[model samples]
Every structure is written in structure tokens, then in C-alpha cells.
Target chain A: MKKIKTANYDICFGIEGYAVLGQYLNEKKYSKIIILTDSNCNEHCLPHFLSNLPTHILFEIIEIEPGEEFKNLEIFTGILQTMTELEADRKSVMITVGGGVVSDLGGFVASVYMRGIDCINIPTTLLAMVDASVGGKTGVDLEGIKNCVGTFSMPRMVIVDTSYLETLNGRQIRAGYAEMLKHGLIYDAAYYDYLKDISNIDFEDLSLLIFHSVYIKNEIVSQDPEESGLRKILNFGHTVGHAIESYFLTQNNKNPLLHGEAVAVGMVIEAYISTQLSSFSKDDYEDIKKTIHNIYEKVQIQADDIEQILSWIKFDKKNYNGNIYSVLLSNKGKAEYDFLISKDLVIRGFKEYLK
Target chain B: MKKIKTANYDICFGIEGYAVLGQYLNEKKYSKIIILTDSNCNEHCLPHFLSNLPTHILFEIIEIEPGEEFKNLEIFTGILQTMTELEADRKSVMITVGGGVVSDLGGFVASVYMRGIDCINIPTTLLAMVDASVGGKTGVDLEGIKNCVGTFSMPRMVIVDTSYLETLNGRQIRAGYAEMLKHGLIYDAAYYDYLKDISNIDFEDLSLLIFHSVYIKNEIVSQDPEESGLRKILNFGHTVGHAIESYFLTQNNKNPLLHGEAVAVGMVIEAYISTQLSSFSKDDYEDIKKTIHNIYEKVQIQADDIEQILSWIKFDKKNYNGNIYSVLLSNKGKAEYDFLISKDLVIRGFKEYLK
Candidate 1:
């Protein structure tokens, strides 16, 4: 069992999953327990979760559709309404058990319901375990804008269990691997190199790698939780990546890219931009692109899509004083944010990615 | 000019109205300014506000209907959408000018829109100037539950100009006076005595009184911003007061009690409760009742309404671990919170109010 504590709360990984959770449940004084999950986790992992729990604990199950489509105000408001109708109060605890969608939505609901309530994250997917469960950023999308409305409210606990990873297929695994790869590329070169041969890595042996990724994220977040300065380093690829993700999700004919997949492509383009604008070595940029491309297939961004993506980027929360800001890697494992990237350079970066 | 500072921001009263605001506007760096107001303030106070501003500072005006009915999720969401449509970003500054409803709703919108934006409160009502502007408790009602969803985000500044009070009717002045009177009863005995002849006081001469009330509130809030412990004392009259306010507001046929009017009655009943359960003297209880009745008309709470009010109190955010807690005054100018008041005692207190 490994416990990494942040400034606010403790996050546990590689522990006996149900036992740790059962202990946590007994520790907190709650009137009722609510488990928020999606259809996927309810069927694939909930049974194992229930078997591991202390028996006779009173809890209610709230399951919703699985996907990014459910990450909106309507869904968030609906969950709040349900909790109210259920008479959930400050003493009520919500254990969100699913991927990024569930944790983000449920964490946000807990933050605003009667001001706030106790919430615990039992992340079921690799992406959620690595990213969503760490930072106190909780929010839902507004009018198709990703995370346009949210708050910075930390959960009481985050329990990461590797057993749930077994339920994910290759694509799901690859999607989560994208964040881990980016973590290494932006913060730890050696860790990035270690993940290069990820195909042959045993699933059981990746626990240490997951812990390293979470630790890197935690260190950055704890230093600057409000994203006023240092925390922007964590948004290395998210600027363009989020734009690509939202662009696809909003279009009827286009299939939305998974968060990690869009981020993977975003890193490639941002790396190219870094090499052009910053002291980032060309060799490092090429290496990052090659590693990410090897793990995740290239996502084709059409020439016409560039305009739409830039439009989305223009409104990014990170931008300030009417300037587009991007966090560029000056070297492997080192990033600096608040770089004013021009539209011409961004267009060139996208052109280079197309080539 | 008198300045009162809290943990997060500073509030100023008795300052040169437009000049102080003009200086505040000049001090902040904003791409554009947005003023959020209601119909009442737009018609009554905006002209004076505009006339006092430094010319060439561009701003947009967003107006909504006036009243407590506008304080809801639908209106909150609508304001957020409008800000997005207007491209109100992090650099945008929102100057909310109106009563408690405007400042509360606009402050909440500022807190949550694009995560948060800089907001300033230019309070037009006495109720707002004394209580709503200082606490940083910004929220809207949910399903008739008061402030069910909100956040504690402070504004950049709160500019309290008593000149706006000249536009208020007698009832508006009395409504806000209730909070000032409560502030005295709970935190300052001398201040309470000063307000005993509130009807004889002139609105133009009440600036120092407003300043004192705000100072008392600021002292208590700074000590306990989250209401985790000591801050609940500020809820002295609010427990029963809020229940009575909610009771009337939620009923269709009944005329709603202004926040202060309901709270005036709540203070009278709570004083009765205090006398029964604590060191409060019966003479003091009758004194509070007579003084309150002298200022505001009696609000009749039917016998049947006791059960409904109790139901509302059962879910107040301050309650924890399934116990309904009340902050009862032990004597004038001092309060103790987290007292577990039983239903039987609460009924007796209400029955005493009826008598």
C-alpha cells in the first residue's frame, strides 16, 4: 500500500482496495452513503467493490450513461436535484466510482450541494486515477465548452485501485497511458523514457509508474492550486488538446477524441511550437512526438478544423488580457507557461503537425 | 471616509460616492466593465453612478427584474450564459449595483463564471449595505430552499454609499435596519441601545450606524469565514428568521416578509428561546420584542406554520450530524452557537411569540 498525501487530503494507491475503502467509510460520520457511477463501472467493477466492503453499510447507487456527453450543466443540475430529493445533507457522503466524467461531475456536485459535502473518489478508469482524482478542480461543461464552469474544492479522499484497470481494453489503456506519457515528458525525462516500451510492460507491474505520475501531478498542484502561476505547467498540451476535444464533441459528423488521445496529438503540435519558439531541443521534440505516436494513433486534424480549434483556444480560461497563453517545454521534463503564442506560429505548428 | 477590512477585501463607507468608485475603477486592469443591476437601481441610481464615472471607461449594462423571485438557478444560469455571450473573461470586471438580491446573485455569478472574475458591490439598499456585501456568501435559491447552491468568493471591493438609501421607501429602510439591530443585539449592546429609537433617526445621518454594523459583521466573519465554528453566532436571529422568511417566500397566497421584518420577529422568538435555555433575562426578551415591534409591523406565524418552519430548520446548512443547531444569545451583544435545541423547546418558543 502506498499513500501520497497532498496539502489537503490523502490519496491511496496499490492498497487492498476494498479494505482501505471500508476503513475510510467507518472513519467518516455520515447519515447516508451515495455511490455515483456509470453503466460501465456498475457492471464491470462494482460487484468486486461491493464484495470487498464491510457488509450492511447503508448506500444508494446512482448510475448514469457512460461518456463525455453527460458532462454538462443539465446532468450536473439533475444530480443535485436527485440528491436534494433524496434528502442528502452535509453529513451525507458521495463516493464517486467511475472515470473522469463521474469524478468530475460528482466532485462538483459535492462542492456546491448546500455549499459542500464530503466526497470521496474511487476512480475506476486509468485516466481518472492518474489525473481527475488529484487536482481539486471540479466542474461541468457549459454550452459545449469543456469545464467552462467549475470550482476548486478538494475531496476528502481519493482511492486508486489497479484491479479496475483490468476491465479496460487496449484502447482504454492507451488513452490513460497518454497522460502518464505527458507527465513524464513535461516533468520527468527518465520516467518518460521508461514508458517508451509500454507495450511489453506487465499490467501488474505498472503500479509504480502510476504512482510516479500521480506524485508529479500532486507536487505541481500543491505548489500552486489556483493555476495562478506554477500550476499552468500542468496544462502543457491541454490548450490545443482541449480545443480539439471540444471541436469534435460539438460537431455532429465528427467523432470526439478521447481526452488522452487529443492531448497526445496536442503534445506533438505543442512540442513543435516549443522547438520553434523556446530553447527546446529538436531531438527532444522529435522523441516526444515519436513516443506519443507509437502509443496512440495519429488524430487527423483537417485544414479547415484549424480555424475552429483556434477559435476555441481564443476563449480558453488560461488566456488573460486578450493574449493566448501556452505552456511550452523548454527542455525535456521542464515547462514554462504564460508564453504568448501568436496566431501565425500556431498555424505553422498545426501545419507542421499535418506534415 | 471609513474603511473596514476583512481577510479577503476592504469595504468603505461615507466616502465621496462617485469619486471613490472612479478611483476603484481606475485602479483595476479590466478589458471591459459590466454592471449588473435590477430594474429598481437602473431607474433610480444608475444615472448618478454614470455621472460620477471617469469618462471613456467602456461598460455594458445587464438588467433583470427586481425581487427575491429572481434569485434562482434559472436566473443564475442565464446570467452566466449572457456573460459568455458577451465574451466576459477573466479580465472582465462586474460591478453589481443594487440591493441584496443584486449583489448576492451577481457576486455568485462572478464567483462561478469562468471559475471567477473580479466583482465589486455598489449596494443600493440598506439591507445589502449592512449584511449582504460583507460576508462573501453569494448564492441563489434552489427549489425554494434559500442559498442551497453558492460559494464563498469575495468581491474586489464593496463601496457603500448611503446616498443610494435616499431612494428607498420606509419599508426598505426598516427591512435593512432589522439586520443592523440584530447585529447590535448579538455583538454590541451599546450599538443595540443606539438603534432602539430607529424610527426617529434620519436616513442621511445613519452613515456611522451603517459603518458600525458593517464593522461588527466584519469582525465576526474574519474570525470564522467558513461558519465552521464562531461564525454561526452571526446566525443568532437567522435560524428562526430564515425559516420564517422561507416560509412566507415559498407560499403563494401569503405576502412575503422582507428579510429584516421576518428576522425582527425571529429575534423576538429567539430571545424567548434564549431566556428559557440560557442566561437571558425575561425583561430583555420583552424589551427586544417591544423595540422590534415598534420599528416593524407584527408578522403573524400561524400555529400550523410551526411544523413547516421546523421542517425547514431541520435542513439548514449549519446543522450537522442530524442535529438542528441554533445560535442563541446568552445576553445582549453576545451569542453562543451549536446549541442543540429540541423541537419541544422550539415549539414553546414559537408559542410564546404567538402570545
Candidate 2:
């Protein structure tokens, strides 16, 4: 197991690491234990997770609906009621055992339950183990407003086991890889270079890359856990990426874009924005765009849709004092914040991504 | 202004202190501002609050239904949508302008908006200005649950204006006093003695008591912000008090008990429990009971209600590792934690309170 500690949070990554959950919990001596899971995890993932635990331990399980739709107040209240019914106390520990949706929702439930409680993240998906598990962000989306309600409560420890990835479909596995590539583009040029040559990799290799990405993320998060400074770099491609994700979501498209997929598109457009504002080298920018296009299927954006997406930029959480700020890359590994960009420039970048 | 700083939070209290909000928010330079209020404060309280602010500041006002009924997920989402439509940005500030209900709901909104943003409290009621405004605790109630969903994000600054209390009803004013009494019971014996002779005191003297109560609370919060140690003392009367409160709430009785009123009854009963188990003198317990009964009308808890309330005791936030731990006063100005009392003792305490 690899232990990564930041100023505000600490995370553990590896296989079979979940067995240590009871021991760490024993040390904290919480008055109660609550396990938060989505329906999918309860069926496919929990039995395997429970097999490693001692039978005598008494705890309650709160199962929420299975996807992003369940990550709202209605479901949040359900978990709160379950905790109250089970008599889970403030000294109790809440364990989130699922993917990004579960971690985000469960982390939020733990954050608000009695104004916050001790929480442990036992990520059961590749997407969660790599990206969402490292950050101290916990929240759920509101009506048409993604992640409109939430908090920043860090878990005491995060346990990641690669065995869960074996259960994921091919689409899920590919979706998870997109975020790993994002880590490489924003921070490590060498890691980006490594992903370019490979068409496919096993979970073992993916685990190693995930470990490195989490290490880099934890390092940045340690310096700025509240996303005040250094942490903004992590949003390199997320600005436009999130807008694209929301745009596609509203259309009732059958194949919903994965978070990483939206982020992948976000990276390309943001990289183009970086080139226009920071004068990043043309060759490096091309390489960044080409790498994403070559691996992920291209998403088409119409001119009118681009305008709508640009309007959504105003709602971006990063905007301060009404000015839209973008995290731009000066080079592969170097990022600059507070890069003021106008509507025309964003439209121009969108045209380039569409081309 | 009385400025009290603790390791986890800071409390600022005084009349006409709303201007201090500008200092903390100067760093972000917010564009548009949103102030959240309830129906009760909108008529008589908010105008006095707006008189102090600069006329040039751009802000929008959003009001919700007054009281605990509106403090739920439905209201939280409605406010979030309004903020989104108003184009509230990261640098946009949310000012909660009411009593505890408004502050708690507004604080929860600000905490989750864009994964957290800066918030300010302009508490109109005496209870909020003294207690809720000081601590970073922000939340809304779930289905029949009190403060079941929330976060602990500190406000930029708290504006305490005693001028608003001029319009407060007699019961509301008395409710705020009960919380002050709680501060004295847990931390200051001298303050408790001071309140003993307040039978004929004017409401103007409440400002001084508010300051002292806020100071004592800030001291204890600073020592243990997360409620890991000294903070437990703050829950002195809350365990059985909360159960009693929940019991009254679920029944939908004619006259719903206010938070402070239920707590007053809880303090009296818990003091009785302390007399039985700890070094607390029985005379001191009687004094506590008499002091509360003199100011507030008595709440009737039927004999049949004891078992139900006792069952709800398991849901207390203070429970740790499956044990129902109660915070009891050992003596005047002193508190103890993790007191394991039998079910019969609690039932007897309830029986005594009914008399």
C-alpha cells in the first residue's frame, strides 16, 4: 500500500488494502459504523468487501440509487434518515464503498451528518481510486446545476483495491483512463508521453499509473486543500469540459458522456486556449490535441451549441467577481491561473476543437 | 465589537458591526451579492440591516418561508436555482440575514455553492447573534429530523445588530435567553448566578449577556473545534433535550416547542441525571429546574412518551461505538463526558420533569 498525506487529507492506494479498514477504525474507536453504497455496489461489490471483515462487528448499510440521478437532496435525505434510524452517532464512522457517484454523495452525507463525521473512502471503481478519491471535494448536483450543493470534507483514510476494476465493463475502464491522461497532461509531460505509445494496458499497469497520479494530486492538494492556489492547475481541461458535459446532458443523448470524456474534450479546447493566451508552442498544443483525438472518439459541437456552452462558462465555479478565469497551460507540465479570456477567444478555441 | 478566536473558528459580536463584513470579503472582490432571509425577518428586521450597508453595493434579495418547516432540501434547491439564474460567481458573497434558521440554511447554501464560497452572517435575532452566528455549523433539517443535513464552514464575519431585536416577540426573546443560560450552565458559574436574579431585568441587558455567552462558547470551541474534547461540554443538556424535541416534533402537537425551549427542559432533566451519577449537588439541580420553569412555560411530556423519547436517545450525535454517551454537569461551571446512565434513570428524570 502507498500512503500519501497532504496538509488537509491522507489517501492509501493498492490491492487488498481494504482489510486494514477495521484496524484503523478500531484505533479511532468510533461509537457507530455506517456503510454508504449505491445499489450497484451493494450487489456486485459489497459481498466481496464484506468477506474480508469479521462477522461479529455490527454496522448499518445505507444503499442509495445507482447513478448520478441519485446524487441529489432526495437521496441525501434517505441516507440521513437511515443513519438516524440506525442510531448512528456523531462519533460514528461513515464508510463510502462505490465509485465517483457514491464517493461524492457519501462524502457529502458524511460531511452534513450531524455537521460532519469521520469518513473512510473504500473506492470500488478505477475512476474513483485515481481522481475523485484524492480530492477533499464532496457534493451532489442540483436541478440542472451540477454539483450545486456540497462541502469539502476530507476522509480519514482512502482504501483503493485494483481487483474491483476487473468487474468494470470496457466502457467503464476506458472512461477511467481519460482522467489518468488528464493528470499526465496537466502536471507530468513524461506520463503523457508514456500514454501515447500504448493502445491498451492491464489493471496492474493502470494501478501503477493511478498511484503516481494520486501522488501528484495529493502533493498539489496538500499545498492548497481548499483550491485557493496550486490546486487550480488540476482544472486545466475541466472548464470547457464541464460545460460540454452539461451541454450533452441536457440534449437527452442516449450515450451519456462520462466525466472523463467531457474532461478529455475540455483538455483539448483548454489547451488551444492556453496556446492563444500563453503563447504555448504550436507543436506542443497540436500534440496535446492529437493525443486526445487519436484515443477518444471526437465529440461534435455546433456553432450555436458553442455559444450556449460559452454562456454556461459564466456559471463555472472558478469565476470570481463575474470575470471568467481559465486555468491555461504554458507548456505540457506548466499551468497558469487567472488567465482572463473573452467570448470571442473561447468561440475561436471551440472552432479549432471542432475542426 | 468582541472578537474571539479559536483554533477551529472565530466569533465577532456587537451592534452595528455589519460594516466589518467588507474587510474579509475585500480579498475576493465579489461582484453581485445575495442575501437570504425568512418571512419573519423581512418585514421588521431586514430594513434596519440594509440601512447600514453602502447604497452602491449590487445585491439581490431572496426570501423563503419562515420557521423550521422551510428548512429542508426543497428550499435549499430553490435558493440554489435563484443564485444560478442571478449569475452568482465564485467571488459572489451570500449574506444570511435572519435568525438561526436562515443562517443555517444560507450557510449550507454557501458551503455547497460551487463546492464552497465566502459567506457572511447578519443575525437579526438575539439567539442567532449569540450562538449560531459564532460557530461554523450550517445545515437544514431533513424529514422530521433537526439539523440532519449540513456542513461546518465558517462565515467571513458575523454582523450582530441588537437594533433588530426591537421587533422580536416576547417568546422569541425568551428563547434566545435560554441558550445564554446554557452557556452559563456549561462554562461559567458566575454567569449562572447573574442570570438567577434576572426576573425583572429589561431586554436591553440581553446584549451584555449575549456577548458573555458568545465569549464562553468561543473559548470552548477554540479548545476543541471538532467536538473531540472540550466541545462535548456544549451538549450538556442536548441529548435528552434533542430526544424530547424530536418527540414533540413528530407528534405535530398544537404548540411546537422551539429549540431553546426544549433545551431548557433538557438542561433541567440532565442536571437531575448528573445529581444522581456525578458530584453535582441536588440543590444545584433544583435551582436549574426552578430557574428554567420561572422564565419559560412548562412542556408536558406524558408518562407514555418516556419510552419513545428514550428510544430516540440512541440517535444522539454524541454516541460513540454503539454506546449512548450523555454529557452531564458534574458541578456548577464544570462538565463531564461519556456518562453511561441506565434507561431507568433517564425515565425517572423525565417523570420528575413532568411533575
Candidates' TM-scores? 0.95, 0.94
Number of the top-ranking candidate, with TM-score as the measure: 1
- Per-candidate interface DockQ score: 0.57, 0.70
lDDT of 1 by residue, A43-159 (tens): 998897777777355788888899997998778778877877777777788889999999999988887787778888988889999998788888887777788888888888888
Q: Which numbered prediction scores highest in lDDT against the true structure?
A: 1
Instruction: Enumerate residue pairs that collide in model 2.
Output: A30-B321, A31-B320, A31-B321, A31-B322, A32-B321, A90-B317
* Candidate 2, DockQ score (0 to 1): 0.70
Residues A116-232 of candidate 2 have per-residue lDDT tens digits of 887888888778988786687888776545666677778888887777887788767767777778777778888888876447666568878878888877777777888887888
Given candidate 2, what's the lDDT at residue A99? 91
TM-score of 1: 0.95
Error of 1 at A233 (Å): 1.1
The C-alpha lDDT values of all candidates are 0.84, 0.79
